[model samples]
Target: MSKAPNNQWWRGGVIYQIYPRSFADSNGDGVGDLPGITARLQHVADLGADALWLSPIFKSPMKDFGYDVSDYCDIDPMFGTLEDFRTLVQHAHALGLKVMIDQVLSHTSDQHPWFAQSRASRDNPRADWYVWADAKDDGNPPNNWLSVFGGSAWQWDTRRRQYYLHNFLSSQPDLNFHNPEVVRALLETVKFWLDLGVDGYRLDTAPFYFHDQQLRDNPGRGKATSGDAAFPDVNPYTWQRHIYDKERPENIGFLQQLRALVDQYPDTTMVGEIGTDDSIATMAEYTRGDDRLHMAYSFDLLGADWSSPFLHNLLQRFADKSRGGWPSWALSNHDVPRVGSRWGGPDCNPKLLRLAAVLQMTLRGSPCLYQGDELGLPEAEVAYEDLQDPYGITMWPEFKGRDGCRTPMPWDSTAVDLGFGNHSPKAWLPITGAYRKLAVNLQQRDPDSMLHFYRQLLHWRRSQPVLIKGEQSLLPVHPQVLAYVREHAGERVLCALNFSDRPATLNLPTGLQAAAVLDLPGLQGGRLQGGELAFEAFGGLLLSLA
Candidate 1:
């Protein structure tokens, strides 16, 4: 029931990611669901985002907290019903927002009917639906593939009389994409959603779609050696080169197929999550042509790297390699610590948050804004006893799971549980102490708040053609400064960021007359006369040169 728009807004647009479980709760169930999200779509639309990227809401056992989907076409009982999802789509469209749901094609929960049937016995009709193989001579796993959740990638299946491959937890088995039937079934599932009028999809764990058919052992990779990336490492999946286990060239065909499926519907688009260690390269590859993903995102910027040179180099590397493909940039997500907490440190300048918003909007590709980011929410501290994530529980202390980023949204400072729901029952992942002070209600009244800055910055970005459709060039990197130029049809803009904690002097190239200056924090006030640009600590300046 979408009143179709005249144009596809995904290209160079901003997408707001809403992790449903933590977004809002209408039923006072202490968990956000479809109804809660529908009610909040206006907030996203008002923020000037063009689309909404909702994480998985499919039926699941919640083993991986909805990442391990049990049913592709039906809504989880905990999340509501299919009718609720349809209502969400309609509401989002009426407000000029495109809805994109996460599609986890690489694997499914062991609880899925298909996986259950496949694992029932070796000769079951759906036996080939999941990845199965014989053990090596020494009775070890069939190959060296590492699970991101920890331990060996292969788990013995008593019913199948062999081992099944799992790139994550043993509870989530990898799908055998090599089987044509499997491909068709997954496509049908996608078609089911499309028929229900979804505007797009966000493919999860996109790189691991296809595995080595030979079940060959993965070569040792990137400073680690030994079995399946096992315990005590970052997600356990990083230990291997991952060349064989993921990022296979064959994945391009499936991407083409998925793209073809999307093409059947006008204006529908797909953005994939490439979680590979070499994510930039995979992102560039997956989105290289119109036949594949419309755009792809990687974790290159989501980590805790805040140095100016690092950001400059990362942008340069992506631009250098992604000549044909489009890139989608994200500063935070449900799986990582909020950028304010990760990068802002003890004294997070509100100005820097404003500058970050400006930078994201002005970047060359479509930007993704995670929920709670507009309020400048930092990472929450979760005690071990309060932990729920399998990934976090598996590796305690060394690497806490994603619960820090998945806390419920703080709407009011005085409201109990920060007004997340009307429940007297305790809510999961208690709202952080620091976040209570920065709640949306508090910021709405403060014109100079981070929320206001985001609103103003986004409004400003929309009017500038140079920002929306500009070609970017990284300027020479100085010690604590990073500069870049954006050129559109005829306009030229020079943007600079100062990453140091102390005031810094920037010597601009000669012959450029500074026409207008945007006063962003981390940048001190300076008259742009002559060719020199001076900045204060952590200041960022956007200049129009004539």
Candidate 2:
């Protein structure tokens, strides 16, 4: 095993996300556990990713799966014990991989002991641990804010004769970050993991940490502009401009405090998940300096919209703005559909998956690769009865939810349970038939396969200093292709992608013209002709000038 890299290692590095419940199940419980992940550290290390970001294994009631925490310090029994987690971390470090765990700080399960004591009575010792307010005379919620899952964001708690605020399911209540003690306690949780030798944290719903303490109503976001049911026409939350609900200025102070703790540890970093609709702005704010998040990412790249112009505009915006901060890119995660399925149009070729990988690796940000993505795997098709995700069950038929993307990885197609090793005949979620056909064992023997392409491209990227730490300039945007230049100490690399299925030729920008086109998939070089380059269907080009 190689030695672990330094703290700045995450900058422009790749992090693989592991949804622990479905990563691997060593105990035959039909669910993945910490030991399962510990055994698989070699696979992750061999994937060429610099770090591993494990989703929550913390103690939870599973109301919202692991997002709703019951305890901040211990691992959930369903995942494994504390010793199992420590062993996993130790093994990951032994493999030269940094471990980053998910921290769901925005809210806690209604069953959490802290929330239990807080809601016992308004005057209890822990009464102010969560957000609780007096109900209006009409017995309605205290404010107009709505939960992201649906309905009013406030829950009526008869025990305290008050309405507690929740930005998600009623079973998951928002914590009062306004309480200084709550902040101190959460900081202690951060220290707990750091003391355990864990590398860092991925803060979930980071901007939602603080709410409008005055309980002020939010203004409307105006009329609907799209037909997507997720952003429904009748949803009042979308109707309002959520001024007081979240993104409070108070969050900066909290971030500074959090950063101070993180700074105290050597070679540690924090990446936040910002879910605001105006995600680019939020990402910029969260990662604006060394005092806040080391980096932040949003759903801008994870949504259904995929076009050359859209990506061009987004990259241009980031290049022009986002100074003093770093951006993180993720094509798919536990929450969204797999990129191969989402972006693989009817006219797109499977070979283009390698091109997509090249683009993700060469972009001006740290990249996050979801499990099984290297094999060009698509979203698994789960039947209605097989669905266990609350998000999918609540909005079934219209929005199938995230379970399709969270299906277990397929190591050996011929093995029972696709080599996941669950003793029971039925696994938690049914493995996708399409994924079985592209299992790892088959791809491992095929040199031209997407998995092999990822290996070659990642190895090449690791050797290129300019690609890893370079300044970006958004080149002139073309209709069917997006172009950009990454420069470091006078060394330049041009990254261009043909987002459309049809072949298109475009003129290269001035400073990018002299490149010897480096075919990332094959590592071969070609000269640019007539100041223009032609890209095949869904193809991408990374050109380097000698």
RMSD to true structure for each model, in Å: 3.1, 3.1
Model 2: lowest-lDDT 10 consecutive positions = 225-234
lDDT of 2 by residue, 412-446 (tens): 77876776756444677886667777888888889
Find the candidate with the highest TM-score and give its number.
2
Q: All candidates' lDDT scores?
A: 0.82, 0.81
Tens digits of lDDT, candidate 1, 240-268: 67778888889999999988888888788
TM-score of 2: 0.95
RMSD of 1: 3.1
TM-score of 1: 0.94
